[model samples]
Target: MVRSNAYDLPTISVQGEIDHPRLRSLGFVDPSGHAQLVALGTSGIAYDVRIGDRAVGWAADHVEPGVSIRHSDVEANLALAYNSCVGNRAIVVSGRAQGAEGVVTGKHGGALPTDRLLVDFSPDVLDKLVIGDSILIRSRGQGLVLPDHPGVSVRNLDPNLLDRLPISEVGGVLSVGVAARIPARVMGSGIGMGSVALGDYDINLFDAQTVEEFGLDRLRLGDLVHLEDTDNRFGRSYRKGMSTIAVVAHSDSVLAGHGPGVVTLFSGSDEDLVAVDDPAANLADIWRV
Candidate 1:
């Protein structure tokens, strides 16, 4: 078994409310220079979209599936983003959906006013949810460390989920199963950010050729993807022979330099962290949601 310091990690409570969807009056321009407007940004409860839904082909930009949540206060929202981890438990504390349970899925970070936390809930629960409903997240898993593999850094992943991952160690090398292996060149927006603790960077699918070659169109919202030659340790950057594993957080965008959002989960050198193809390597599949 892989050893970790997960047991020593402390869990905290962070509260947030369902965020309302946003749209700019001026609309947006796509990569082809076409001015267009559509449903975009964070939504209270995305009824048609869920963890296993297709991320591409959506008429939205940076659109979060399921429920998008954030604290009304800026500083508190920051805490909610930084402290919450994927696979953490979320509870609806107020509103018609009170007592409903969900799972923290991912975080949205980019050129936005605030970072939003994504949560996955059942359809019935989502139907009852409304904008501004309070949610209490049992946040944990920030300071996680693999005792045997010092080169690998873990971020934004819950300890319980970590234990259930399709991970195996052989000859001091950790092999992690992922849904897709994305090239580093496709990474865009939020690229130069100095922190991976909260939010996410984009996966650029603007190039049709690259998209076909990578089969990126098939990418789903909860899929685990490996970023080749990427380093998200301190910030997002290209480091030779490095690898970063991240989860697809939000849907595709019509704008340039932006596509589906992916939040960092693990980072290290290719020698230390190897990616293995596993089609079922998705959060939705793992959790059977």
Candidate 2:
């Protein structure tokens, strides 16, 4: 397993809650210029549903505001964002859900002032978790490195999660198991970001033809998906002969230029990533989460 040289990274604590931001107009125009009012972003209990649950929905399935934390301390929030990675351990330090543990599933940026970081807790504990609860993160996924593959870049992923992934070195090449293969041309929204460690990108499911062709409708919330012809090293951009492996963070959205969200695990170029199919190719299954 890949481990950081410096094992003394400081554990940082940042608190957030379910934010009920007032919207003058909940109505939004879809990609087809159709009006929609879908409830999304933070709070409420999302049940044991998986991806592809509600292909036609006004809300993001299986992802709600368990706790949202960001403050005027932009630098500090950014640091917390950078330190916390997918699959890291998170404990409810305060509130009724105190001592309960969960996993960091994904992160959202610029969406809300305080709801930047998005985490996932089991349904049983969600009710106990209220807004403004203290969340202590055991942040330790920053210094991960693929010692063998110098070209691939890793971000917002725990090394332990990486180990559980079915990535293997066979015949001097790495094979990554993915639930589905998506085309880079379909990638929309949240691109050109300097770092995915702080946020995630979305796969626009607005095109009916593309969704049917790629089998994206079967994606699960934590499924590991492969995006062909995409490079997210410096920014989310289309690059031929490049591919990125990411985990689905959120559910499908009816909003314009938005769909299921995905955070980058690592990216490789020159056709180094080989896509293989596996039904259990998801974070929840990997760690038995």
Candidate 3:
């Protein structure tokens, strides 16, 4: 994995330029009942059709809630070896079915996907696997960069709340920035859901009622939302000048290779977020005092 300065937020960078004469779409299904083409990351091909600001759920090709398969499901000729692994692809480097392969899957709890890609391994191989084992990933997509926008900022976040954010009932849906113009989707997993506080957010797709009530239908990808920042370490507060902001990027969990939606602390400190009615306000405009 690439590393940056501690103060400099981490981001992905592409190794080479892609100059395909004719690009194709991923034909991904969004949570809002729409079919759209999507980029795996900022480095991949850019799409033409834009979606609304509502948070939509997305996944790497072939990922589901309870579906497990072998790495051969996606790749046919994967080699099995110790530490000769790829980043997001899955390979059965060791065990009874030592040669079997799986998708790189993702990282959460104590287990992480071999490559940034999801790996599918046979149940037999999975059962014999132990912690500290290595897998492989055939990394794709363009490089990602931590966006540099005043509307977005980051701080030490409460892990518990990150895990508790609601999930969208509709496919590929998530609640994003306050504006209604940005277009982005959610994807992936291991965003510390089920775990709280060590720097995770339970980001989920907002329901229809909340989406309408908050005028979320107007939001677009890349729009920044100034979350009601607060000092309360345990719960949420909606006060003026007491909120932080995050940008709506992909519609995926923060864990694994998927990018997490972010709220930066550019204007205020952790304590600056207080209580208020509009929790997702662009405070930079109203709170600049």
Best by TM-score: 1
Show the lowest summed lDDT stretch of 10 residues, model 1. 107-116
Ranking the candidates on lDDT from highest down gives 1, 2, 3
Alpha-carbon RMSD, each predicted model: 1.2, 2.9, 16.6
lDDT of each: 0.90, 0.69, 0.30
Top candidate on lDDT is 1
Q: What would the per-residue lDDT of candidate 3 be over residues 164-221, giving only the tens digit for each residue?
A: 2221212221222344221122212333233211111223333445445555545433
Cα TM-score per model = 0.97, 0.87, 0.30
Once superposed on the true structure, which residue ranges of model 2 sit more than 4 Å away at CA? Answer: 1-24, 43-72, 110-115
TM-score of 3: 0.30
TM-score of 1: 0.97
Per-model tally of clashing residue pairs: 1, 4, 89
Candidate 3 — number of clashing residue pairs?
Answer: 89
lDDT of 2 by residue, 67-158 (tens): 45444466666666777888778887878889988878777653433436666677777778765676777787776667667677788877
Please give the lDDT score at residue 9 for candidate 1.
94
